[model samples]
Target: MVVGDASLDIDTLVIGAGPGGYVAAIRAAQLGQSVLVVDKEYVGGVCLNVGCIPSKALISAAHQYETVKHASSIGIDAGEVKVDFGKVQAFKESVVKKLTGGVSSLLKANKVQFFQGEVMFINENEARVFNEQEAPRYKFKNCIIATGSRPIELKAFPFGGRILSSTGALALQEVPKSLVVIGGGYIGIELGQMFSKFGTQVTVIEGTNSILPGFDTDMSSLVAKKLKAQGVNVVTGAQAKSAEQTDKDVTVTYTVGDKEEKVTADYLLVTVGRRPNTDGELGLDLINIKMTDRGLIEIDDQCRTSVPHIYAIGDIVPGPALAHKASYEGKVAAEAIAGLPSKIDYKVIPLVCFSDPECASVGYTESEAKEKGYNVKVGKFPFSANGRALSLQSTDGFVKIVSDADTGLVLGAQVAGAEASNLIAELGLAIEMGATVEDIALTIHAHPTLGEITMEAAEVALGHPIHTFVK
Candidate 1:
């Protein structure tokens, strides 16, 4: 406890009011716990304030701008179109404000006391939250830490001025004339493609052989084709060495094999990866919380940490750094604290990228199933055959399904095309419920719908396809 600090007792104290923490706090309150939530910054966290929502808004706006400019081929002629970036920024900010305000109202309705301050653990059950003025001590029966991660800054390129992080990229007042992106992960690809659509010359330098390295080559290739068509210069297998920034522009030095190359841009955006915000003033060491070498707090199936009364979830825990994953774990952690049998299952967590021809995957790929000693039946159907895709002029991708050869169980599925983000939910539910390819195939999908693509792929798996010729 700090000197001359008043202590407030809480039944549950949740740190970091991001998707994970806010959800956990609400759930805990619903379960009869008097909860208190504290966030150092925005109530909706990075995903709302800067990351997912804002990025998607920009992506959507860019698509509108692109469509209006190039709709002549379809005979829907619109005259010369231009983007007012100030209005775009206004739109994005309005979205953020609405969502974050909703979250605050939810907390108030749930009777969850909210505070905004930096949290530092004083002991196992006590923490001090401090802002610019006062520090208040909080004593809790249970605690949940959901502090999210931040962009990993490379030693060679620190974020400032012309060198920007994802948050910095999203907050740009005006679109840059040119951008050099280091790292080809989902964050890099989404921002790079968004800028390219807005008429910015984007050069993506990736260390691996392909962009979106986590995805299968087939899916990544489609996105790569779209990026190229959008005039994004993709440099695969390239290493970013350093960045030099001036008032007007920035230059990046990189090497591939034996050749060193230099690229100049209006700004440099680095999205290498994210590091968990675990090693801050929140003293996990003081309470001896078991953590990994990478600073991820170790948690059990129910999200319980080494300490029985404490739980950890989201980016600080061991799993994918996804907002949905964090929100799901948040519910589980809150339920577990209330004596519910809630455990985590990583198998059905979906991964999505909002790049052109969006890519989404849940469960095992064919190779992963084979490596795990399962006889897998793979079915693939291209969007080129789908009437809905043809109508949308987005026939550039496919739906691939991986199933158990013996039982026809839907082990996993991948989608790369329009509405891939929304279409993956059914696949995730199928995997979670142990649904089979036969189940999906037998279910009637509306005519000329994107979901029919999944049904056709299941038909391919079951040895009877309607749309495509079987080999």
Candidate 2:
């Protein structure tokens, strides 16, 4: 990385060293290309730094706390659980440090040079990288723009002292006595549930009639029921009108139907959604690259932009803004640069929400399979019937399989229960490999395990469920 007038030449330049960018760089370098990856921030991007990794760490801590506090019901007499949030944050940071360090090491091993600075397009073939003290120019044959998105901030509840974004909420030193969460989406629900388990009075305000709006009522209803039992105040069909912040606390005023209501809390958390990082720095207009009206870059199946040499992936491009999705696209873009025929397949991408008991989905839902004009055959098996779930005292949800009625092809699957996050991977593989319900049923799952729920669900689809009687 040299500063001044002369430009260093490279085969590929990847901007925004998040999951997509870093992965793209490594893959490109592996395929015998000179790759230089640059970002305005850290290597592992939002997921490793503040988003997925840290939030899950905190959620795990919260879950452990709740488990110990309520273990008396299971014959364990654990007395008086107290939370040291400072230590919890330390644990989260340690995990982040280890992962980020590992990512840095991986990049180094791949022979991909990294720059911790911002990159702006000099042209379609070139970019200028700069930091506080040094600025360098680079001319590359190709580029991959993988800049990720950031949390959207509302004008009425500006983030700062009392108003918090998802990032701000995760960085809190102490858990508040009370919290008002605006938006009952997965993020809001996950964070709200975490705080609730930590002894915070949580009130979730959502504009939809029910929480987790995009999910099916059958799956989301389990979450809503669990939240109610945890004493989380879920006010659906409401809009967050405004908020007032003081040093001591924040008061949020929202509306339900025609009525106006206000709630005072220690802090206000806004988790509506995220906006892509395509606005200010990258200068996409300079290169005349095409973008959508929603500010997302338009890309083909190979993650190639309008400019053949330039590609885009991750949140900046269309589709769900998930880390794994970005990483998958990253590989495709890198392979395309290497003259390989790699492309993206959205059907097998699994999405998991790390809420209490968890929720996971792969491919289409039952309604989605039907809407897609498939002869949908639905089968569901409750966790209550699973011996492992019963023994673990986590019989709150079910595993559902959606397959084609005639062909018996596994169209999609959903899991809502303990280990749902881990369990969805097998279903994703099933869909990816074009497996049938009978295939899954014939493949033996270990006895009395949670995974048997999936097998039983497949058996239910095959019309011969073992655990539960059918008419």
| Best-matching candidate per lDDT | 1
Query: Which ranges in model 2 have alpha carbons more than 4 Å from their true place?
Result: none
Per-residue lDDT of candidate 2, residues 25-61 (tens digit): 9999999999999988898999999999999999999
Q: Candidates' lDDT values, in order?
A: 0.94, 0.93
Model 2 has a clash total of: 0
The sequence of per-residue lDDT tens digits that candidate 1 reaches over residues 50-127 is 999999999999988998888997998898888899999999999999999999999999999998888999899999
Off by over 4 Å in 1: 1-6
